[model samples]
Target: MRKLILLVAMLAMVLVGSVPALAQSTLSGDQGANPPESDGGSVRGIITDISGSVVLVEADPSASSGPKGYFTVTDETEIARLEGDIRIRASFEDLEVGQQVQADYAGPIAESYPPQGEAGSIVILDEGGETDREATLSFELEVECDPPANAAFFGFIPAEGGINAQLTDPDEDGVYTGSVNVPKFPPGPAPPGTEPVSLPVQIVQVRGVIKDFGEVKIDGDKTFKATVSFCDDNGGGSGNGGSSSGGGKTLPNTGGVLPITLGAGALLVAGGLLARRLGR
Candidate 1:
């Protein structure tokens, strides 16, 4: 009986030692983990408001339609990086409250009632369609030209049609500098005569009156025009105060034409007189 009891204790000790090894192997191997590819489709939403880790977003109705219609934006670190007030292409711009936008997203689905929310990220795709996405429709107001030493002039109000854009002048000069966040608009179906659709930034010529200046109120609105070159990933430069038709403009070379002709005529007359004198 004593020997049998000893043998039973030995067996228990061996089993305990082997249990840890089996657990380690399971953890190192499959470990019952789900792959990331299992998550399909994407969700898009706007950051309407932020409360702690919860982000209230007004998602696009067209994208979120059907059974999984409702979508909300949560305060996830990954999602915050992609948000700005106006959705400009390439440059970081703000999105206005009423402005429409699209978001790309993907995550896990809930299995229980009330639908437990899944974690995911979102990126701004588009603001509105072509008619709304033109550059000429927007305006950039210069607040101040001369900033304080080492300090830049800040704060410019966005007009009714445009979104609020902040400028950061690194040189501390009055020149306000900043990026505008534009939306990534999707391509439409190809028309019969048109070539296959490709994504390109739309260029526009802006023509409007400067309703108001920075914090300081100007006496009257200033009428001006500028050309905006914009694209999904990049945009560049502004040319203002010009007519669409290239006309009535004095070209550089035209000024010299009259002077050269007069000089040649004068020289020819002088040569004729000199020849008469030499012949006599």
Candidate 2:
């Protein structure tokens, strides 16, 4: 009985002692299991907030709606702030709220709401940065008709009363062309406690219609067609529909850790049983 108690005690000590080494090995393997960054995409928006290595970006609204969430920003991320014709290198500490910026990152971007991907590089847009034009962006379209149309019209959405403009086919060709200037920033006072208006990156739906008959306008007779595009030149940049990165956080492997813990517990239970039997 004494020998039995000694054997159980020795077994428990051996198993318990091995637990630390097994756990350490398991943790080291987990550290290496993190996925590496690959060729990703980009996102441009204003920084609404920051926590740890993550920053919440108010990306341009799109047809596919989702909630705004946090994006991981890390030391490896290349950050820069534009200064009048020069791109000044920046760090994570320099990022601020309300500044319009663009982040280019590695992929494959996670398909979660308010999608996420790590930024390989970030550029802060100055007032007149290369891609930060505040001027009107123009749109053009052409239409086909039998007889030369007496009048043509074009329009886009999200505009006050909807934007409307007359189109012209100057060359007498059935193809008609027209353009509307949309400012990168909406003109008006921003709502109280809100950031300045940044143009939404959307599939701008443009419509064009031509009327051949003068006085009487017939719906069937008038040639109508629609065009759509994701305007990247405006608030949109070369990106994965405005996404951020949370790729750094990966779940650790518990396979090895679990066994180590279980073995230790089993050994302790056997030792207790042996000691209780000896006491009896």
Candidate 3:
């Protein structure tokens, strides 16, 4: 009886050791190199390391069981920074280590240790240690653009291109509202000795009507304008070259996982960089 009891205990230990593998296979439903192709998925977290072209992201602790992931970003992988309604093109160099990011990819997330996946697009979700020269411009405006299909709104710096935000259709009819993000940019050089008061944004509201008259007709467009102020997030007013945080600081090189926050900005895949327009 003593010998049998000892044998049963040994078998229980082996079963416990093998439980994880069995669970993984059951969870993945496939135990090969690829688990199974996911329609598409997104991983939001902070970048911990950048080796060659692979970016190591530390998943948020709130994540079910995923801890860290390796994303392979390539030249073809689209990188964009959200500024108001526009998504500006960003290079790999723009992806500083320790910055918060969201990588959208296809294919099944690898089941291997330190799970890996191929990144199709990576977005800089947080300013992290971006310079003081940049600020975030967030705004919401009321407009009279009717028929959502014939109206568009833009927030720009005039001579230099900025960002664009799209208007939403009204459930109440004829009224449109939108929120935009303009990030990491100064209002421009301040006049000598003059505090950079406010940004003179060319708020262009374009209204157009498409006329398909026997296929030989063209559409006519009319432009309208307004002015608004954008301030930095770091307690600096719209005056004096907007305030910035994390200045003179560099990204982290720590070897630990990180956290992520998302769902506040727009993911514009509407063509390349937001069309550079002045609502003109």
- Tens digit of per-residue lDDT, candidate 3, span 37-98: 22246667788889988887766544434556778886678887644333556778888887
Off by over 4 Å in 2: 1-40, 61-70, 128-280
lDDT of 2 by residue, 2-92 (tens): 9999999999999999999999999999977654322235556777777777776656544233334346776677777664444556678
Instruction: Assess candidate 3 and give its TM-score to the true structure.
Output: 0.32
> By TM-score, how accurate is candidate 1?
0.28
lDDT of 1 at 280: 100
* Worst lDDT 10-window in candidate 3: 209-218
lDDT of 1 at 91: 15
Whichever of 2 and 3 has more TM-score, that candidate is 3
Go through the candidates in order and give each one's C-alpha lDDT: 0.36, 0.50, 0.49
Model 3, residue 249: what's the lDDT? 27
C-alpha TM-scores of all predictions: 0.28, 0.29, 0.32
Model 3 misplacement above 4 A: 1-40, 61-67, 107-109, 127-280
**Collision pairs in model 3:** 83-181, 84-180, 84-181, 84-182, 85-164, 134-184, 134-185, 135-185, 196-240
Residue pairs whose backbone atoms clash in candidate 2: 39-107, 40-106, 40-107, 116-244, 117-244, 117-245
TM-score: which is higher, 1 or 3?
3
* Model 2 TM-score relative to the real fold: 0.29
